[model samples]
Target: MAPNVLSIAGTDPSGGAGIQADLKAFSANGAYGMSVITALVAQTTTGVVRVQEVAPDFVTDQLVTLLDDVRVDAVKIGMLANAEIIRAVVEVLDRYSPRHVVLDPVMVAKSGDRLLAPEAVGALREQLLPRVDLITPNLPEAADLLGEPEITDVEQMPAQAERLSALGAKQVLLKGGHFDGGDSVDLLHGDGVSEFLGSERVETTNDHGTGCTLSAAIAALRPQRSGWPEAVREAKLYLTEALRASERLEVGRGHGPVHHFHTWW
Candidate 1:
């Protein structure tokens, strides 16, 4: 049976990220996609201009209603606006107990507008990190989680990944896209063991929604029971190809989304 993957995140109207991206990623892997909206964002490739959070009770209701019925194979969590919402998600996880969980700690957008609250960071690490099978954090988010300002060198990523594990995460994927170089290297760090995944960074300003896409892909495919490192590595390759295929399709004035339908069109 194909895996059923659930995504809990806000909606991005542009269809480039958030629930839309999650769904696209889900479909790319031929898995069923389920979603619970945490909030709604007024956003574009430029930045997030406004956000209206979903009611905490409503969020809980959606989760409970879904979990009580379907047998979710995997769960991918993104963009819970506040600590209360985070707590609500944790409660549901504890109750239903999905076999595979992927957490993409989406703190800020690629354009630098905050997607998660600074005050809620502690709740995320303390309450939610331990529940997940893998937590995907880019450099800035990793720094915030580790309480450090700089993770400039690629060599330091293993230590930071260890720090994330110490904070209750079973495994962490420290994305190295923001690092300076022609090549992109992502560190899959867990138990103080590090595996590096790399690709020649695509030369395009249209990269958007990559984190959401990659994590959702993993969640959708994970119940094949692949290891975390293998899942991440495969998803990275898929995302890179999507990036290359979408480089020329500048749909918007700002950063554009990946060509998720490249296989078809």
Candidate 2:
């Protein structure tokens, strides 16, 4: 049976990131996808223009209503617009602990637009960080979470991953994509393990939604694979292929989306 994976996130009507990318990645990785929308974002492949947040109570209603019936095997969390919504999500997570939760700290977009609010950072770090199974944060997001400067070197990743793990996430995948390198590397730490996962960098302008896609793929593959390491390895391979095949798609003028259906289409 395919795992029933839920994506709690904001929207990207352009279909490159957020809930759109999540659902695509979920299905591509062999999971049945579900969604609870947290925000209505007016965005294109180029940038986010406007964001209208869903009410906090309604967000709770969406989660409770869905979890009451469906058997959710894993969850991928993306852009929660504010602290109120984060608290609402945390409350429901406590009530019905999903088997696996992957948090992609979506602080900024590919176009350099800020998605998460400044005030909500503290709420996410203090309240929600401890509740998730794995958190996938790129260098900038990790620095923001820890209130430290962004790391410039790969050697700095392990210590940062460890610090993030100490915040109570069972595991942390600290991404090194921002660094200039031949390979995109990530440090996975926690559960008494520290390993670096790397892939050959595919140079392309159409690399939008990589974070959302990667995290969603991990959530989708987690229940089927043996463990986090296996799931992450497979997911990274999927994203790399997607990046390599992105030029096959011509979506928007700016950083376009990765090809989620690279294997099929």
Candidate 3:
């Protein structure tokens, strides 16, 4: 059967990021996509203007309702807007114990608007991190978790990935996109293996939902692959092609989205 993947995230009405990107990535990866929106974000490719969060009880209801029916194979978690929502997600994961959980530590948008509340960071660490199979954090998000300003170089990623792994995740995929270089390298550390996946950086301002896309694709690929490393590798390749195709599309005034359906046509 195709992987049954769920995205627990916010909504980007402009269709560039959040659940929109996740669902598209899931479909492109040949997975059955599902979603539970944590918040309704008012934004385009330009920036996040405002946000309306869903009630925690409703979020729990959504999770229970879905888990009651669908046979979820993997889950992609993004943008939990508050501590309550984080707790709600934790509760569901504890109950169902999905096969794979891809946690995207989505703290901020590509435009620098904060997606997660500052206070909720602690809740996420305590409640969600331990339950996830893989935690994918960009340099800035990793820095936030580690109480550092930012991870400045690729050399530091291994140590940070190790630190994050120690925090309870089974694996860590530290994305090195912010590094000043020609290639975007990612470090995957866990399961007695440390590997780096690198791809030539595609020059484009339209890289909005790359993080969400990568994590969701990984979740979609997780159940089908032999191991987490192969899932990460395939996701990276898919995202690279998506980025290359995204460079040509004109979507908005500011940073646009990577083409999640790039492989389709």
Summarize candidate 2's per-residue lDDT along 1-265 as a digit string, tens digits: 9999999999998899999999999999999999999999999998999999999999999999999999999999999989999999999999999999999989998888899999999999999999999999998999999999999999988888889988888999999999998999988888888999999999999888999999999999999998999999999999999999999999989889999999998
Candidate 3: pairs in clash? none
Winning candidate number (TM-score): 2
Q: Which has the greatest lDDT? A: 2
| TM-score per candidate, chains pooled | 0.97, 0.99, 0.98
User: After superposition, which runs of candidate 1 have C-alpha atoms over 4 Å from their true positions?
Assistant: none
> How would you encode candidate 1's per-residue C-alpha lDDT over 40-69 as one tens digit per residue?
999988888998999888999999999889
- lDDT of model 3, residue 163: 86
Number of backbone-clashing residue pairs for each candidate, in the order shown:
0, 0, 0
lDDT: which is higher, 1 or 3?
Answer: 3
Residue-level lDDT of model 3, residues 1-265, one tens digit each, is: 8989999999998788899999999999989999999999999999999999999999999999999999999999999999999999999899999889999999999989999999999998877999999999999899888777787888888888988988898999999999989999999999867899999899988899999999999999989989898899999999999999996678999999898888666
1 or 3, greater by TM-score: 3
Root-mean-square deviation (CA) per prediction: 1.2, 0.6, 0.8
